[model samples]
Structures are given as structure tokens and as C-alpha cells.
Target chain A: MTLFIQQLFDGLALGGVYCLAAIGLTLIFGVLRIPNLAHGTLYMLGAYVTYFFLVTVGVPYVAAIGLAAVVLAVIGVLLERIVFHPLRNAPHTHHMIAAVGAMFFFQAVAQAIWGADFRRMESPISGSVTILGAQISWQRIVIVVTAVIVLGLLTWFIKRSIHGQTIEAIEQDRTGSSLVGISPSRVSMLTFGLAAALATVAAGLVAPINLLAPTMGDALSLKVFAIIILGGLGSLPGAIVGGFTLALAEVMTSTYVSAAAGEGIAFVVIVLVLAIRPTGLFARAVQR
Target chain B: MLTVRGLSAGYDAVDVLHAVDITARAGELTVVLGANGSGKTTMFRTISGIVRPSAGSIDFDGRQLPDLSADSIVKAGLAHCPEGRHLFAKMPVEKNLMLGGYVRRRNRGRVRELLEHVYELFPILHDKRHQPAGTLSGGQQQMAAIGRSLMSDPSLLILDEPSMGLAPLVTAQVLDAVAQINRDGIGVLLAEQNAQTALRIGHHGFVLAEGRVVLSGTASELLDHPDVREAYLGV
Candidate 1:
């Protein structure tokens, strides 16, 4: 039972990272209606930014994470204004191609800047605590706490704040939102920037535990896509629930079964879920 | 307070409106009556800056509004309540209404005041203020849509098919609310397929057929026209 509890906490720590990435992806899909394929590249870039800030700039760990978030947010806003805004009314195919192109471009850029090698950051929190007779890394604790706080704040913002409600309105009906004076374009830019910042934060949090490489984000991106599919696309709460569930399942499977089979677990669960609720766990009945 | 001259717009490869001329003055309820595909909604879209005009110009409140964005247009005091009650489905009714005042700078207090006013106009919405807009009845959604538009505190309020998909009694309530809104000093530009009800409340009426205004007159005059009776009023 203690082992089970320990495994659950470990699963939750990993889930926190996935939740941040998935939330970003879901938010971008919700407001922009564009599946941002480059989102993972942004995540990798964030890790690299943190690395540079810590190693070269000699910034403190917390400040490095903060700087990475702000930097990525600026990059996101720039991408929105330069790339996404012009393609607002373009065909879905065009956006898909553009996003894929952006992903490749960012990958190339990261490889050029950071090189094609795997780099891992030193953990800011190197200590551990005893929880239920299990050793728990302080970093893991930080991850879980940060995820809950960020997600909780995000939920409150979306549910209670004015700008967040406007974004929600735009997501539901773009044309209708425009009629009510909510600028879809402006909202799109904000959502994209926000998604990018979230990816950065996720990368900063997980870089200590995970190796960072230019291509590392590709697998993470796929996992996020799976999470989005499992959670309804455009549902923020769904992303959180889906991320944690997928993470726990993967961890349990890897522990009980072969490690090789653990990777396919998320897909198996996704397929089963899709068979039952094709619209995903949190899909609203009304189609956009 | 609104004028359109030689305005033309269409979705890719299909022209909807061709050189349409429309005008709405202050303190008047101007109704645009048409059949489906007659470009009534298209006209509203053009005026509200959703559908950009292919040619000519739209002058709202004495300013040429060709390249302005939709929110900017709304900020300029023109509010559009679109055809469908596109209330944010997952959001609460109060939040949806607050979004309508997104561009208003100093009218937050006024927004609260208007909320009470709107609640009085459609008492049903007040009861459902905390509920998700998607949970509201069709008529209630319609009222929320209109109330949302009014939240912007626009001098010119444009509504597209405000009476669509409702029982006659519900339609009467909506139209009555619209008339009440107009009586409170805002100019209204209403597009509707229900000609008899629209014409009954309008100060001036324009009949649109295949994009252009086929006829225009005082509401009573248009109501009495033999061609209007045959084609639109069904009397």
C-alpha cells in the first residue's frame, strides 16, 4: 500500500508536467482553432532558455524559470503577429502545414543554438522528504504544488475574470464574439502567447528530471495530443484530468508490466475511451 | 446615425449583396425585411464590420468605417446582436453579458445598472444569471443576446433575426423588449424575415430582395404596399 501511494505521487509529479503542456495545447486549440504543432518546439526552447540563463547568465533557478516564461511569451506573441494572424481566415490545411513548418523551423533553430545533444539541468531542489514511509523528492513536491496552484489560478481566471470569459466566448463562437465586441484576433494572440508561456513553465519545471534535446519535445507533443484527444479538445479541466489519468496509467503499467509496453498504454486507453465516448471525456454536446 | 452606400460583399466566389444602400437615423427603428438568402444578415454583417465591403463605404456616426475591426466598430457605439443567440455556451449568463461590455472604458457601473434594466426587460434571464447560457431556453437565450449587445451601451444597436425560432408569444415578448430598448433613446437596425411583426414596430422599413433594397418607405406605407403584401407580409 505504501508502494502504491509512492507510485501515485510519482505519477502525479509526471502528470503535473503533462497537465501544463496539455493545458497550453488545449487553450490554443480552444481560442485559435489551430492545433499548434510547434507547441512542443516552444517547450524544448523553454528548457534551452532556462539552461542558458542558469549556466551562462548565472541566474538563480527560480529567476531562470521566470525569465524562460517571459521570453517564450514574447516569442509566442511575435509568432502570433507574424505567422498566425495573417493565416486567420486561411484553410485548416494551410494552418496545419504552417504549424508543422514552424515546428521544423524551431527544431532547427534549437539544434543550431543548443546543439543536437541531450542536456539535463541540475535540480534546484535536491532534497527529499519522507511521505507515508516513502522518500519523496522536494522537486516532485514542488512540481505537484506548482501544477495545482497554476491550474487553480487558471481555472479561477477563466471562470471569474473578464478577459478570460471573453476568450471563452470567442472559443465557443468567433463570429458571435465579434458581434459582442470581443476581438477574436486579439484574443487569439493572447491565447497563443499564454500557451507558449505555459509550455515554457512546464519545461522549466521538468528539465531537471528529463533530458533536454531539440527533438525531445516531439514525443512530449504527441503525449499532449493524446491527452487533448482523451480530454475533449478545448476543455481546460479535461486536459488536467486526462493528463493525470494517462500519467498514472503509464506509471502503473511500467511498474507492473514490461517497461516497453508502458509507452503504448496511453494509446490503448485512448482507443478504448474513444470507442465509448468519441467526443472525449469532457466534450460538450454542441458541436462548434 | 448609420449609412451605407454602394456596399457589396460575398463569400468566396458567390456574391450576396450588390451595391446595397441603407441608412438608419437616430431615434428611429429601421427594419430590413427579406427572405432567407436575401442578404439581410449579410447587410448587418457589413454594417457591423464582420463582413468587409468589397466596394463603397459605410459611415457610422459620421466616421467612415471601412477598415476598422469589429470591436473598434462596437467601441464606436455600434452594437450587433447576431442572428443566432451565440451566447458563450459554457459560460455563466452574467459572464456572457459582461463580455458584451469588453470595449467600454468607463461604463462598468453603467453596465451593472443596465444589467438590472435588462433583467427587468427579460425577467427570465435574471433568474438564470448564474446558469450556463447553453442551459437557457431558446427565448431566454435571445433575450440574453439582446441584453449582451445593450451592455456595450451603443447609440446604434443592430439585431439580426431577433425573432428567429420562437413561438409567436415569445416573438412578441422579444419584439416588445426590442421596442422598449429603442424607446430608451438608442437607434435600432433590425433584420428579420417575419415581416408583419417587424413592420408593425419599425419607424422606417426597407424590403431587400436579392441584395438590393427593392422598396423603402415609412413602416405603414411599406405595410400597405400591394407588392409587399404579396411577397413578404403574406396577407
Candidate 2:
């Protein structure tokens, strides 16, 4: 029972990270209709930016995270304008190809700037506590709490705020949005920026628990795609629930079965979800 | 307030709208009558800057409209209520209306006033204001769509096939709302397939066929014209 409780906390911590990752990618897909194959690369770059600010520049941890998010946001905007915007009218394949190209190009830039060595960051909150015979790291607790707050705020913004409804408006009907004075281009830029910022914040929170590498986001990207697919694509609540579901599934599998099966859970999820409910668990009925 | 001369536009290489000349004056409801595929939608798309005119010009209140973006055109006070009644289905009715007022969002008080005015015009929308726009009945959806356009406080409102896909009574209700909106001092450029009804409410009318303006006259004249009577009114 104690081990199970410990694993649950572990799963929740990882779930928080997974939710952040899925939210960023799904939002861009939901609004821009671009799958953003390079999203993981953005995640990796975010961790590196956070590391540079906190360690190299000696900035305070919170300020470092904020700066990193801002930097990633600007990078995201540039990527949208230079790559995605040009391919907006192009075939879907072209957007994927461009994203893959961007991934490779940005990865090379990171390798040159930071080197390919595996690195890790030290968190400000460095301690552990025991509750109900389960030990939990403060950092992990922070991750879970912060993720909940951020997502809650995001939900409010999208649902209640005027600027955020523009995103929802464009997602529902592009032509209608234009007719009513919502600028798709401007919204696209803002979506990309916001998604990137979310990614940075997630990476900053989780990097202390894991090693940082240029390839860190690659596997996570696949996991995030699985999450969004499991949750209805572009559905916010779907992503959140799917994130925790996948994380818990993997954690339980790894503890009870082989670790290899844990790593393969994403593939299992993709296959099962595709076969059973292709539109995902929360997908609205297809519009006529 | 809005003028188009020799405007041509199309998807890819095929032109959908040929050098179409149109004029919609301030304080008048100008109706464009056409059959399916007669380029009424394409013309509206061009006027609203959704499609770039390959030739000629679109001038609105002395400003060249074709040079602006679609959203900019809305900001310039020309609102388009598109043919399909494309309400953001997943969003609430009030959110849809608020998004329409996004351009003038800085004036929170006026937006609230606009919301109240729209509610007064279509009380059903206010009753269903918290409901998803997609869930509304057809007539109520049309009312919401029109209310959304009005939220932008447009000087010239262009409605495309506002009566499409509704029961006769609902169509009359929606058209009646359009007439009410026009009477409130907003210039209206209406496109419709229902000629007799449109002409009855319009100050003047233009008949379009095969991407060209086939006829133009006062509403009563077009209502009496043999060509319009035969082609559109099915008299």
C-alpha cells in the first residue's frame, strides 16, 4: 500500500509535466491545424534556456524560468512567421516536412551552442518529505501544484477572457472568425507564443528531476502526441485527463511488470485508442 | 458608402466573379439578387477583403478596401454575415457575440450596450445566451449571427443568404430582424435568392447571373422587370 501511494505521487508529478507538454502541442494543433512535429525540439530548447539563465547567468530560479518562457515565446513566434505561416496554404505534408526540417536545424544549433553533453539543473527546492509512509520530493510537489494552477488559469483565460475567445473562435470557424474581425494571422502568432511559453515552463519545472539533453523532447513529443490522441485532439480537458491516465498507466506497468513495457506504453496507447476510438475519448460527434 | 468597379476575383486560375460593378449607398438597403453560383458569395467575399480582387477597385467611404485585410475591413465598419451562418458552434452564444465585438473591445461599456441592444432585437438569443451556439434552433442561430455582425458596429452590413436553410416563418423572422437592423440607421447590402421578399424591403436591387450584373434598378423596377421575374422570382 505504501509503495502504491509512493507510485501515485510519482505518477502525478510526471502527469503534471505531461499535461503541460500536451497542452502546448494540442493548442497549436487545435487553432493552427499544424501538427508541429518540432514541438519536442522546442521543449528541449526551453530546458537549455532555463539552465543557461539559472546556472550560467546566476539569475534567481523563478526569474530564470520567466525569462526562459519569454525567450521561447519569441522563438516560437519566429518559427510561426518564417516556417508555418508561409506553408499555411500549402499541403499538410509540406507543414510536417518543414517542421521536421526545423527540428533538425534547431537541434544542430543547440548542439553547437551547448554541446551534446548530458546536463542537469539544481532546483531551489531541494528536500523530501514523508507522508503515509511515502517519500515525495518538494520539487515534484511543486510541479504538481504549479501545473494545476497554470492549467486552471489557462482554462479561465480561454473561457472567460475576451482575447482568449478569439482563439476559440478561430478554432470553431475560420471563415466566421474573419468575417467578425478576428485576425487569424495574429491569433496564430499568439497561439504559437503561448504554446512555447507553456513548454518552457514545463521544461523548467521538470529538468531538475531528469537529465537535460537535446534529444529529451523527442521521446516526450511522441508521448504528448499519444496523450492528445487518447484525449480528443484539440480538447483541453481531454489532454489534462489523458496526461495523468498515461502517466499512471506507465508507472503502474513499470512497477508491476518490466520497465521495457513502461517505455512502450505510448505505442500501446496509440494503437488501442486508434483502433477503439480514433477520434479520441472526448471528441465531439463529427459535424455534418 | 461602398463602391466596387470592375472587380474580378477567383480561386486559383478560374475567375468566379467577373468585372462586377456595384454601389451601395449610405442609409439604404441595397439588395443583390442571384441564383446559386451566380457569384453573389464571391462578390461579398471580395467586398469584405476575404478574396483579393485581381482587377479594379473596392472603395469604402473613400478608403480603398481591397488593399486592407479581412479583419481590417471589419475595423473599417463593414461587417459581413456570411452565407452559412457560421457561428462558433462550441462557444456560448454570448461569447460569439463578444468575439464579434473584439475589434472595439477597448470600449467595454459600448460592447455591453451592444449586447443589450442585440438581446432586445432577438430576445431568444438572450434567453439562450449561455447555450452553445450550435445548439440553437435555426432561426435563433440566424438571429445570433446577425447580432454578432451588429456587435462590430459596422457602417455597412452585408448579409449573404441570411434566410438559407430555415422554415418560411423562421426566414421571415430573420429577414424581419434584418429590416429592423436597417431601420436602426445602419446601411445594409443584402444578397439573397428570395427576390420578391428582398425587393419588398430593399431600396434598390442588382440582379446577378453567371458572375456578371445582369440588371440593376430600384427595388420596385427589378420586382417588375421581366428578366428578374423569369429568372429569380420564378413568376
Candidate 3:
């Protein structure tokens, strides 16, 4: 029973990373109305930016996360202004192509700057604490707790903040939103920038727990995409539910079934869910 | 006040409005009457800057309007209540009304006052304020859309087909709100296919057909015109 409890906690913490990453990817997907194949590249960039700060500038770990978020947001805004904005009206395929090009461009830049080799950064969080009979790292606990706080803040913003409400309004009816005096282009820029910055927060929390490389995004983006699709595309709470569901499936499969089956669980579940409920688990007629 | 002369606009290679000349003065209601597929909507869209004019000019409040974006036009005190009651379906009614006052976020007290004003204008909206906009009845939704447009405190409010898809009783209630809004000193440019009801409350009216204004006159003159009576009034 204690072992099961430990595994469940581990899965929940891991789910926090998935939830943040899915929100980042899906926010851009929802507002900018772009598939944004380059999202994972932004995620990888976040980890590297923090690495740069830690190794070169030597800021404290928490400060590195802040700097990375700001830097990534700038990069995202520049990318949208220079590349995405021009193609916005051309065709949907054109935007998709630009995103692919962006992915390769960012990936090449990362490889040139940081090299193709994988590197590890030691977690400043030291030691572990026991819950029930199992032990968990402080870093893991901090990642989950901080993610909850960030998610709470985001929920409040979308529900209460004027800017966030404006964004939600634009997402629902672009023409009406503009008719009422909100610039769609401005909202687009801000959404993409914030979404990219959010990718950094996910990376800052989770990248240290795993191996990092330029190719790392290629693998992880697929999983995060699955997480969003599972939760129902463009639904914020859906992302939350989908993240934990995917993580729990993986953890449970690994514990009771097999490790190989654990890795493959997300795909299997996605196929199953899509076959039965095409819109997804949480996607209804109206999604907030 | 708003003026359009020699205006032309449309989707690429398919012009929906042509050389349309119209003017709307302050504190008066100008109704543009047209049947379905007529260019009334395209005309409104072009004037609001949703569709860029291919030629000629639109003057609003002493400035050329073709170059301004829709949001910029709204900020310049022209609010468009688009067709289809396009409220954010998932958002609360109060939020929808608040979003109507979005451009005035810097003036919180004024926004609150605008909210109260809209509630007074449509009390049902205040009662359903916390409900999602999509769930409202057709007439209620129309009221919300008009109330939303008023939230921005626009000097000119452009309402496109507030009568669409509503029962006759509901249509009267919604148009009553429009008449009241006009009486409150805002310039109202209304596009409607219901000539009888629209002309009855309008100070002036224009008839549009196949992308051009076919006729224009004072409301009583339009009501008396044989052509308008034959084509639109179904009298």
C-alpha cells in the first residue's frame, strides 16, 4: 500500500510538468490558432537558457528560472513578429510550414550554441523526505507545489483578470472582439509570447529530472501533444485532467505491467479514447 | 457622425459592395433596409474596417476611417454590434458585458457606470449576468449584444440585424431598446431587412439591393414609396 502511495505521488508530480507543458502548447494553439510544431523547441530552449545562466552568469537556481522565462518570451515575440505574423493570412498550411522551419532553425541554433552532447545540471535541492514508507526528493515536491501555485494563478487570471478575459473573448469570436476595441494582432503576439514563456517554466521544473539534448524536444513534444488531445484541445481544465490521467496510466503500467508498456501507454490510451470519444475526455460542446 | 462615398469592398475578386454613399448623423437612427444576400452587411463591415475598401473613403468623426482598424475605430467611438449576437458562448453574461467596456478598462468607475446603464436598459441582462451568454434565449441574447455595444460608451452604435432569428414580439422589444438608445443621443446605424418595423422607428432610411443603395428618404417618405412598399414592406 505504501509503495502504491509513493508511485501515485511520483506520478502526480510528473503530471504537473505535463500539465504546464500542455497549457503552454495549447494556449498558443487556442489563441494563435496555430499547430505550432516548434513548441517543443521553445521548451528545450528554456532548459538551455537556465543552463546558460547557471553556468555562465551564476545566478541562483530560482533566479535562473525567471531570467529564462523573460528571455524565452522575447524570443517567442520576435519569432511571431518576424515569421508567423506575415503568414497568418496566407493559408493554414503556410503557418504550419513556418512552424516546422522555426523548429529546425531553433534546434540548429541550440546545437551550435550548446553542442549536441547531453549534459546534466545538479539540482540545488538536496536530500529527500519520506511520505508513508517511501522517500521523495525535495526537488520533486517543489516542482509539484510550485506548479500548483502557477496553475492557480493562471486559473485566476483567466477567470478574473481583465487582460486574460480579453484573451478569452478574442479566442471565442475574433470579429466581435475586434469590433469591441481589442486588437487581434496584439492579442496574438501576447498569447504566443506568454505560451512560449510558459514552456520555460515546464522545462525549468522537469528538464533537470531527465536527460537534455536538442533532439529531446522531438520526443517529448509528441507526448505533450498527446496530453492536450487527451484532455480535449483548447480546454484548460482538460489539460489538467489529461496530464494526470496520462501520468497515472504510465506509472500504473510500469508498476503492475511492464516498463515497455508504460512508455507506450499514452499512445494506446489516445487511440482508445479517440475511437470512442472523438472530441476527448473533457471536451464537451462548450469548453472554457 | 459617419459618411461613406464611392465605397467598394469585398472578399478577394468578389466585390460585395459598390460605390455606396451613406451618412449617419448624431442622435438619429438611420436604417439600411435590404433583403437577404443584399450588400447591407458588407457595407457595414467596410465602414467598420473589417473589410478594407477597394476605393473611395469613409469619414467618421471628422477623420478618414478606411485606414483605421476595427479596434481603432471602436476606440474612436464607433461600436459595431455584429450580426448573429456573437457573444462568447462560454463566458458569463456579466463578462460579456464587461468585455463590451474593454476599451475603457483604464476608467474603472466609468465602466461600472456603463454596466449599470446597460442593466437599466435591459434588466433581464442584469438578472442573467452570471450565466454563460450562450444559454440565454434569443431575445435575451440580442439585448445582451446591444447592451455590450453600449458598454463602450460609443457615440455611434452600428447594429446589424438584431431582428434576425427572433419572434415578432421579441423583435419589437429589441428594436424598442434601439430606439431608446438613439433617443439617449447616440448615433445609430441599423441594418435590417424588416422595412416596416425599421422604418417606423427610424428618422431616415436607405434601401440597398445588389450592393448599391437603390433608394433613400426620410422614414415617412420611405414608408410611402411604392417601390419600397412593393419590394420590402410586403404591403
What does chain B score (TM) in every candidate?
Answer: 0.97, 0.98, 0.98
Q: Write the per-residue lDDT of candidate 2 for residues B128-211, one digit (tens) a residue.
A: 999999999888888999999999999999999999989999888888888888899999999977788999999989988899
**First chain of model 3: TM-score?**
0.96
Give the Cα error of residue B195 in candidate 2, in Å. 1.3
**lDDT tens string, model 1, B1-235?**
8888998988875779999888899879999988898998888888888887788889987888777888889989999899887788877888888887788736678888877887888888888999989888888999999999988889999999988999999999999998998999999999887788888888999889999899999999999999999998677
For each candidate, C-alpha RMSD in Å? 1.8, 1.3, 1.6
lDDT of 2 by residue, A103-141 (tens): 998899889999999997987788899989999899989
Name the runs in model 3 displaced over 4 angstroms. Answer: A284-288
The reply for model 2, stretches above 4 Å from the true place, is: A284-288
lDDT for model 3, on a 0 to 1 scale? 0.87
The candidates, ranked best first by DockQ, are: 2, 3, 1
Which residue pairs in model 3 clash with each other?
Answer: none
lDDT of 1 at B188: 94
Sort candidate 2 into its docking category: high
Best by lDDT: 2
**Roughly what TM-score does model 3 have, to 2 decimal places?**
0.97
Q: Residues B151-233, candidate 3: write the lDDT tens digits.
A: 99999999999989999999999999999999989999999877888899899988888988899989999999999999987
Q: How high is the lDDT of residue A279 in model 3? A: 86
Best by DockQ: 2
Error of 3 at B6 (Å): 0.4
